[model samples]
Target: MTLGAVAVLASVLAVSCAGVVLLTEQALTADLDQAAALRARDVASLLPAGRLGTTVPGAGEESSFVQVIGPADQVVSASANVTGQGPVIPAPKDARQVTVTLDSSPLGSEPLRIVAVPVHLPSGPGWIYVGTSLVQLRTTMSTLILLFTTGLPLLMLIVAWTVWRTLGRALRPMEAIRAEASQIGHSDLARRVPVPPHNDEVGRLATTMNAMLDRLEASSRRQEQFIGDASHELRSPLTALRTQVGVALAHPDPEHTRDLLATIDQQTQRMAALIDSMLYLARTNRSPPGSLTDVDLDDLVLEEARRLRSIGGLRIHTAALAAARVRGSTVDLSRMLRNLGDNAHNHADSTITVALTTDNTTAELRIADDGSGIPPGDRERVFERFTRLDQARARSSSGGGTGLGLAIAQQIAHAHAGTITIDDGDRCRGAVFIIRLPLSAHHGP
Candidate 1:
């Protein structure tokens, strides 16, 4: 890029200098012609008026040739340089000046620019001619051309060098950024690009790159934490399954072995559930929702409530359900509802209330359980993955959950452009998990 820019600049400079040289040459030529005409006018004024023949002045320091001619088109008097030459130019029909070139002259074979002016002299009507050699003018123009041709390239080279230095200094910071960025790796996200002192584009780029590194580092830490938590959760079930199987093998009795096998199956199911939840979360994190359709949220709520009702321990109240439709993936919406219902069932003391309703623009589903209510401080924390609020709410008689239900529910809600929040229950002194989704366009009656 620098080379290209320098090349273009040099081209423009060369063209401009050439134009200046040409213009200078033309201006010099015009000045010389004007001086010759003035000399001719002065010599004509000194001659006898209405004269036919007059001795013109000799060649002077400025190297001009003068001549006087009679009305018969014969040279009567001539200057020293053109002493024996015939009339250098024909007499003009009028007094106006005219330019002519003399090809043959006593001085040399060089061309001369002559100006002829008709004058009325005492002897007769005559013409005066003033001629000047163009050798000096041509020489001056040649010198100017030589200087321009030689000096322009030197000037262009100097300019190119200066521009190259300036651009290198200006881009030094960017080079530093590139070098630092190249050294950064996934394991070293803590490193940042150096910011320049000047608040220019380079500085902004450095700041942006540092900000991206910050995000990558935070994301990496979260990933590592998630893997650690998942490994711990999986190990518990695997250890229990191995111990139970080992005990069953040692006993080898049919009834005892059957009980042991049943215990092993339960543990296996728990592990399967945990793995399934992790897979669901991972899938959702990796991709956005696909195949959206109008989902009847009320029907999903009622379905989960009915399924929980068959569990038989708690009374499920879902009479407040209304036709609430939302646009989202049906499977994701169903998973969200089931997660919320399962959480409520696991925590409720005696009764769980499931209610669904809609306002003008939003569909709301609230699931509350009559258990030890979640503290204000712990409400949000309980929704984090692998969080078990066993102290805040009693663990279900069935077992402690894998602690991913509320987190998965929240992820699903957010995927559908919705929000899930914890608030006080409307019917009982328990925690209420409210899910709010935007209403579909065709939702109204």
Candidate 2:
């Protein structure tokens, strides 16, 4: 049951119980007061005023003990109950008077409720007193109290039961939602937690949870597809190399076998390098750094460019260097420069230039290769995993290229809260890759 319903029921029951008790007490008191007043009136009407009529019938010669007194202080008649108890009641000094119980009795339980009136007749004026005990009043009130006490709790119980049942029924949508959620799996992300067509908090919660599930399912499906594509792409070269080796091994001739063996060796090297590149990308995805730290990007870029030059494959040059500080892994920075250098060597007219600089809040590394420039639209997506220029595949030599190199470089940059983009080179005629990294993060990696 919801807390709101329970609270409402408790408040209602409390107020009702309190009201019943108060109203009952006031009403019972009023009834008793009215009954007592009537009894007093009857007693005053029956009194006598003259000695012939004013004398109380039970009064004996001991007049002081039970006689009624007139206005002249003459003895008339007396009440046994009133006169028996000494000075049981004060002599009436006014016409309108009140009675006081003379002695204790069972009647005291519902004591006297009366008013005495002065009597006047041809003989003289005197006083008569009357009262009614509170016994009948008590019995009426007790019955009321008993009924209220017994009935009130039953009412509260009914209220509590109604609160629990109604609240549980109102929240029945949650049960359906739970059932739907329990059946949904990573494979069946298309399913959604059902939400009722109601503008309420529970409905809103169901909608929000369903939206979150949709996004998670989409991300999971994308990751699965990415792994499958990577596997297929990696297997192609492996299968070709294996077939080539089997062919060469079958043909045993001195010079021909040597040539075939060398071809096998080269293909084996490319295959191993591709596997390594795939592994590097997989690691970056698996363990992304929480932050990027201080790195000397200029030195890192210069070092990787020189290493590419070691193979004596491309004319690599650099802009006059400066201390370019950035928040990124040194290894990742070098990997980005080396991949750009290798890409340039693959297609350039043999020239590569590396540049580095820092702007407010953004530090950048730019590598330019005098290669056939990437088309404007394709430049953005080339860094996606396994994507390559359609032209690069048909070329006989590939400068040790694996399609994942640029993709790996992009992943590493993003892990550092940075980006890698391709732009127009020095003369705006060849591919230029620029990496941008954010600065001033206040926490650790």
Candidate 3:
């Protein structure tokens, strides 16, 4: 990059300096030509005064000289500097003015800028030639050319050096980030790249990268914990099934064998349910969300209420069900609603209220049970996998169910780009799981 910048700058400078030299040459030559024309006019004025052969003042100092020629193109008179030279330039017939440059003049070896003008001399119509030396103009132009030839390269070198150093300094942080990122592994996610103090682009990039690393590390830790908990939960049913099988094998009683088989089936079902929940969590959390369709949330709420009513015992009140349409995976939404309803069923005493309502932007679903509410401290913890609370809030069931219902519900809600939270504003006798999902764009009254 630095080299390219220098090359571009050099090209521009070369073109500009060449233009300057050309313009300077034209300007200096124009001035010299004008001076020679004036000098020839003054010398012509002297011819009618009959002083054509007199020595001219200031004309001898430099190689400047004057001459007069007869109409027949013969040398008539000359300046002191070129007294014996024939007419340096031939005379013209008409009284027209002209200018020329002579490389080798009669006065000296230096070039001359000369102007010839017709004059009415005392002898007849003749021409006056006035000239000035070109040594000074040539010297000035040579010095300028020399300066540009040497100085332009020096300027380019300086520019290249400055650009190289500035770019290196700016990219130094990115190099450090690359090195740090390369060394990071799954085993060591705690390390972070160095952040420069300046609040520039590099600093912002480093900050963003570190933020991503922080999220990755937190996710990794959570995954490890989830694996450990899942292993422990699965082992419980396996241990029970193994012991029950061993007892049945050792005794072989017909009546107890039936019960043993039932127990084994129950443990196996529990293991299956746990594995299914884990798989669901993995799929929902690890992958992108699936294709979504508009689902009537009110229908799902009424369905859950109907299911609970069929179960008997508890009074399910869904009087607040309103027409709310949302966009989500229908099967996943159904499973989420079912898990919440099951959680309410497992904990409710005499009543469960399932409510659905909507506003301009979101649909809110609240499922509250009349059993003892979760403590304020454990409200968030209830969403964690296999979390157990006190006897009143512990998620227990006759089917040896895995305590993954709330976790599954929360994951499903998140997959729909929604939120599920236990309502802290409810000061009543039950936990209220309030889920807010974004309304579909086409939702209407």
Candidate 4:
């Protein structure tokens, strides 16, 4: 980039210098032509008084040659430097000045710029020609050309060097940031890029990168904790299964073996459920719910109520059921409802109520039970993975939950751009899980 910038600047300087030389040449040429015309006019003024061939005062300058011509274009008088040369230029017919160039002249064979002006001589109407050598103009232009050719490169070199140093100083902070960032790893995200003192672009970049690293560190810690929790949760069922099978094998009794098989099946199913829940959470974490379709919240609530009634022998009520539509994945919506129903069934003493309703912009589903309500302090904690509110609710069920159901349900709710909160049940006088999802545009009035 530096080289490209220098190259472009140099090209502009070259063009500018060339233009200056051409303009100087034109201005100098015009000055020379004007001087010759004035000299011709002066010489013509003397012709009315002085005789021909008489040496005129101030007419023998080294750079100028003056001559007088007759009607026939013959030289009648000449300056000392060109005394024998014919008229330096052809005689003009009128009083207007004409500038002409001479190939060979008394001025050492170099070109001469002569201006011929018609004048009324004492004898008749003749012409006066004044000529000047171009050596001085040529010398001035040559000097200008030499100076521009040499000085412009030197100037460009100085400018390029200055630019190079300025850029190096400006980018030194970025280089330091790159070096620090290169040394960082997943194991060490606490280190941060250095920020320059000035509030410039590099400082802002350093600040942004540090913020990104902070997020990455937080995410990494959460991932590690999740993996650890999942491993611990899986180990319990596997250990129970192994112990039961070992005991049954040692006894070798048919009835005992059958009971052991049942226990093993239950443990295996529990493990499967835990694994499935973990997988769902992991998948959702990696990629949130995509391409939402309209899901009937009322249908999902009724379906989960029926399933929970058959499984838990709890009286399920849906008196508030209404035709409410939400935009989300149907499968995820079903999973959320099922998890809420299971949670309500596990905690309820005898009845689980599933209700659906809608407001101006949101569809709300409430699942409540008549069990001991969750304490206000533990309400938020119940949604965390692997959390079990054993103090608030009983954990004496034949197949206790894996504790990820409510967490997964909350995640699903958030993915649908909705919210889930624990509140006091209106009818059950127990904990109520209120889910509010954005209403789909196509929902019926």
Candidate 5:
């Protein structure tokens, strides 16, 4: 338990008990004082005035512990042992009887309560002072105090122990998890935190952590594989470039050197394209967290089509729809559009049709080309990095592709919680790339 909780609990318990104790004591003392005053008034009125004041040194004085006040507020009578002692509690001033006390301390007197009363004698309404011993009351109060003082520590100790034990049990699983997690790193992604059987907040936290670890492990493996494959792909072109240069160097013929230089230039372009695609892929993974913004998909597609149409590679036609939007990073969205446009221009035998439209729930952009269509079975596989459609690689000049354009496009689409799908193009044996984003991207009044 925290010290603060302990202090609060202790204070609450003590205050509650103390209030009840004090109230009980006050009631008892008031009752006793009233009883004492009544009896004293009766005893003093029955005695003669002078005789009440007369003192006895031995037997009478030893037991004498009372006092009597006259009507004029004079101590006309007193007990020898109690003379001028105890509070000078005033006689009742009004006709209606009331209770009052002067001492603030609980143990102010051996008899804590005293009272004064008026007695009607032949001379006048003389007053009588009455006080009783508080020895018995003191004994009772002392006993109660002793009981509270003795039991309070034991009660708090039990409470503290219970709280401490509960807190430890609650945190034990997390401690074990922390220790196990400390030894786990990139090499030991297989290790996982043990989630307990109970369904509690802590259990939920452990489950979430375990799920995160699993995702990280899978992502790490994929990254490693990508790096290794990229390295191999880059090395192959460089090796071809070196081989061509070596052959030209050995022959020293001008025609041979020119052919070798051309071959070297081709290989260099291939390597450059590969590196550029890899750099784009790296950018896809380097997307800033929490950077999504509303994007106008309709305007973007029409703009891209307009820009590509002027290049004269292939006629870019657009059938744009209004208010086609999504929430995503502008950089990734532009890259996705640029890659789709590049791929469409490269493969299209004639015209590239860019269609932009939206359903009530989703926005879609379709880029279709008038070229040989991809087989249904190979459509999905073609989007993978370094994947080529055999024939696409054999094409001349700009038509030949490194096969990363589609992969990069898919990655950017997925980053925006969207998907890219392929279908048959209209009036052509070509493929259509359909990219869909949720309509939640449309943030408007």
Candidate 6:
């Protein structure tokens, strides 16, 4: 980039210097031409008055000279510098003025600009010639050429060096960022690029890069944790199935084999459920919702209540369900409700209450159980994948809870542009899992 900038500047400077040289030479030449014309007119004026002398005062001087010629092209009078010179220039023909330049004249070897003017001489029609030296103009042009020829290179060098240094400093931070980023892989996401101190474009770039790195590191940690937890969770059912199969094969008793087979079937279902949940999570995290339709949130609540009642142990209540509607994927919403209901059934003592209500913009669902409420600090942690509270672990295992129910519930809620929070908002005994989803534009019964 610096080299390109220098090249462009060099072209501009070359054109500008050439223009200046041409303009300076034209101006100097115009001035010398004007002076010579004036001298010729003055000598011509003296001729008509008959006061013209054999030699003019400025004759043979370095500044100007004059000569007078007769009609027949003979030198009638001359300047001291060109006493016998050939009329300085040929006399005018048909009373027309003529002008020319002499490379070498009787005056000197230097060049001269001569102007011939037709005059009405008392003797007859003749011509007067005036000459101006071109030494000053030539010297000025040579000096200017020398200065431009020498100074332009120095100026271009200075400009190139300046652009190089400026661009180097400007890009230094980006180089550091690139070097650091090149070293960072998925395993090294924790590292961040160094930030420059000044709040310039480079500094802002470093800040954004560091911010992105922070997010990538956090996501990497969450992914690693989820993978580890998923592996551990899946291994339990696999191990139980393995052990049960081994026992059934070793012992040939019919009743014992049947029980072992039943246990194996149960373990297989649990593994399937766990894998399905993991797949659902992966899909939700990676892509957007496929389609959406208006869903009756209150209907989902009553459905979960009926499901819990079908399980027979838990008393289900859905008294406060109001006509609430939301726009979301029905399958995802149903999965969310099922997960929440299963969680409540597994943890509730005897009563699981489900209620949904809606206001102007939000449809809120509350699912509460009568079991031991979650601790304040663990409320948020309960939504993490494969997280089971100590008090509920045994029940989770016995009831075939995948430990992904709440996490899946939360994911679905967020996919529907909703939020889930565990709170005692309704003064429930156990943790009240409240989900708030945006109300459909047109709500109906």
Q: Which candidate is the best by lDDT?
A: 3
Candidates in order, TM-scores: namely: 0.78, 0.65, 0.88, 0.81, 0.73, 0.80
Candidate 2 lowest-lDDT run of ten = 58-67
State model 4's lDDT. Answer: 0.83
lDDT of each: 0.80, 0.66, 0.84, 0.83, 0.72, 0.82
Candidate 3, run of 10 with poorest lDDT: 391-400
TM-score of decoy 1: 0.78
Candidate 4 pairs with clashing backbones = none
Runs in model 1 lying further than 4 Å from the true structure = 28-72, 76-85, 89-147, 312-324, 350-370, 376-380, 391-400, 424-429, 434-436, 439-444
Clashes of 5: 3
Which one wins by TM-score: 4 or 5? 4
Evaluated at residue 193, the lDDT of candidate 3 is 96
| Sliding window of 10 residues with minimal summed lDDT for model 1 | 391-400
Error of 5 at 376 (Å): 6.6
Query: Tens digit of lDDT per residue, candidate 5, span 50-130?
Result: 443344222122312455555666665565665555336666777443444434322343344556555664456765655
Kindly list the per-residue Cα lDDT of model 6 for residues 205-230, writing each as its tens digit: 99999999999998999999999988
Error of 4 at 52 (Å): 11
Question: After best superposition, candidate 4 residue 64: deviation in angstroms?
Answer: 3.8
Per-residue accuracy of model 2 over 1-445 as CA lDDT, tens digit each: 4456557766786687678777876786566556545543444455433234433453232211233455655545445544433223556665665555432332233354443555663457765444445555557667877886787668767777887787777688889899999999867888998898896888998999898997898778767877887687667767877787777678656767767777767767777777777778667767965355777676687788778788786787876555567776776767666776777777688788777776667777777888788999898678766677863454222323657777877777888788888889776779888888775443222
Model 4 worst lDDT window (10 residues): 391-400
Supply candidate 5's per-residue lDDT for 365. 81
Candidate 5's C-alpha runs over 4 A off are 1-4, 15-17, 34-112, 119-122, 128-132, 289-334, 345-351, 358-363, 370-384, 387-392, 395-400, 414-419, 423-430, 437-445
Better of 3 and 5 by lDDT: 3
Q: Which of the two, 1 or 4, has more TM-score?
A: 4
Q: What is the lDDT of residue 97 in candidate 2?
A: 54
